[model samples]
Target: MPVIKLTSNTTLHYQEMNRGAAETIVLIHGMMSNLSVFYFNIAPMLAQRYHVVLYDLKGHGLSSKCTWGYHLQGMAADLIQLLDALHLRQVHVAGYSYGALIALQTAVSYPERIQQLVAIEAPDPFEQQTLARIDAYSKSALLEQIAAAGKAQGKPMSKRQLERNYNLYHFLLKQTTLQQDMLAEKDFMQQPGIDRLLHNTLLLYGTDSPCASTGKQLLRKIPNAQLAWLAGDHHIPVQQPFQVGSSINSFLQPRENRIHHFQPSATSIGVETPGWNLAM
Candidate 1:
């Protein structure tokens, strides 16, 4: 329920934990979802050793709603501004789904302000199936999707939860420019700087996820990156939160210790964090 107004006058609701820790991490939830995705399991586990901030993206969850600024460029800027307003210098960032793309964009645009990157199930926007859900938005479909997502997490959506989620969905699909802006991100993965990003990065994807291909693409695109497959599909994080949280924790450990844990696949090459300093 915590809220912050960025310099742009856009307000965002966020959750924070372990504020007194030495290091800070920000978790961003994907489209149509809020901070609660990480709030339940991921944030708590990461907070034991690091300060954690999980915030709903603009136009989602209790955040300010705007018809514009749904593009990655704007979303990334909003994230940086959120950090600035919170007085956080540089911090680790982890995002899921579309949120993952925003994290990459932020790191690409403001490399000096990022300590590490964690991208979970970041799909290629160019994929037709990726945007089909957006283009084919329907109120009933949204409700079914939310209900299924909740069911995947081992709890069916209650009537109130279903109504609340549907309202957010209707607003985003009907009142906001989310789909159009997302469509504009088709070239995101091919950006010239991708192959050049040297941050210590971790890529998590469901083994069976169609997005695994995009993860491989990122593994090849990012210099110091590695991909780890969990046993699930695109809903992997919610399907397997403990595994996801454990992987993130192990990856954030010291480089030497972390390196051995990530056994590489043939396509997942050159995984090392030589460009980042551990002292941070």
Candidate 2:
């Protein structure tokens, strides 16, 4: 029930659990999901080692809805302001699906405010063939399946037909959004004033997931990025949280020392202190 007010009169509902060092870890959920999805998965494992922040994005959860567009920039800005209100200067970020796209934007848009970023299965520029496959997903039949599942909400996707229907719907939504979002992407990714702010980023993908290649590609683009693969599908963090958690913890343990490069500013509270000097 906790909520924070942003500058544009948008109210975002969030949950916070304090742990670890002063550093904060923020979790952003995907399209059609609330922060609760991560609650059963990533949050608990991370809470033991990092101050955790999970919040609802506009329109998706208890957060305020925009009268206009649900653009990624707006979402990223909302996160930035949320940090300001919480008195957190910088944070380590992890996001999935649409949230992953937003996380990527956050790193680019406000590079200085992000210390470590992990984008799990977000999309990238695709080939023409990829677009063709995406287009097929937007058919009316798929959208109807999605709408039905959205309405049903936990009535048990116990049947194969039911699960297939839900997956179809998810595909439709992503396809619809990709078409509109891609147009703005070129300009957004190449803003002149934006710096190639570098961070030690982690890119994750599921071996059986469609997004795996994009994860690998992202690692190539980001100089400091590292890549990892889990065994399941797109929802690996959900289906195999423990496995994902183990990988994340192991990766971070060795790199803990590098997190202290930046000084805390008004926009970066709960950031890693420069001189903790821990031997992990």
Candidate 3:
């Protein structure tokens, strides 16, 4: 891992592969995650051609958490400062879930720093549907039970304590608020610059994913956009890394005078053969 100092004494942690290459791809992880999440899923596939950079978000994983707030815009600004310190002017960017949202802010704040953008399972800032979805999942019976059990045992739960806390229904619904800031919406919606940069982006989500509708909605709003639905819900890139890599590689390939099939059809999303089946 490499370290880049941000404002204050705080430093950002990141890793890079194939440094000398024609193009670079910076992979940003979502909330509650670190750079390692992308290693098994995306790095191997992208390392040969593009210089791949992966990093921890400000307060997540191995990075320092000295910031005053958990605002996404602050995170985006941190990334801009990172690129400046590294002398990297522009690069291809891809982010998953919360990371995707931050990537959107990055694109808006510094449009010249992005060559292409890919957002997977990223939702709009303040849509009713998004709010409703978050509220529904947050207050679900299963999660409520889990919280209760965790409370009954103690705050800091052990592995066995957690395993016993889970109900059958809990297994079916994935946990969405593991380490997310509930206050993120306030910071996200207050900003106006993000929408302008979304037009030149590619949106993706899994077919079986509950968040697929958000991806579709984004596609409708963005001009050079397409929605790709992968086979697995919420974990396509993790489960089917090679296939996800192939799809992105094909999409990001540069075009000459001919307008090569740039637009993705319905079939191009998540039609790949099932690879690993990891339960998230």
The 0-to-1 C-alpha lDDT of every candidate, in the order given, reads 0.80, 0.65, 0.66
Off by over 4 Å in 3: 127-195, 257-259, 263-280
Total backbone collisions for each predicted model? 0, 5, 2
lDDT of 2 by residue, 66-176 (tens): 443456787789899889988889998888866887888888888888988877767553444333433342243245445656678935334785565455445434533
Best by lDDT: 1
- The candidates, ranked best first by lDDT, are 1, 3, 2
Estimate the TM-score of every prediction.
0.85, 0.71, 0.73
**Model 2 stretches astray by more than 4 angstroms:** 125-183, 186-195, 254-280
Output the lDDT of residue 45, model 1.
Answer: 94
Error of 1 at 262 (Å): 3.9
- Better-scoring candidate (TM-score), 2 or 3: 3
Model number with the top TM-score: 1
Model 1 — which ten-residue stretch has the worst lDDT? 271-280
Please state every model's RMSD to the true fold in angstroms: 5.6, 9.2, 8.8
Lowest-sum lDDT 10-residue window in model 2: 264-273
Q: Please, what are the lDDT tens digits per residue for candidate 3 over residues 121-202? A: 7866566455455445334423544566678985544567445334312422233332244345645634556445543566
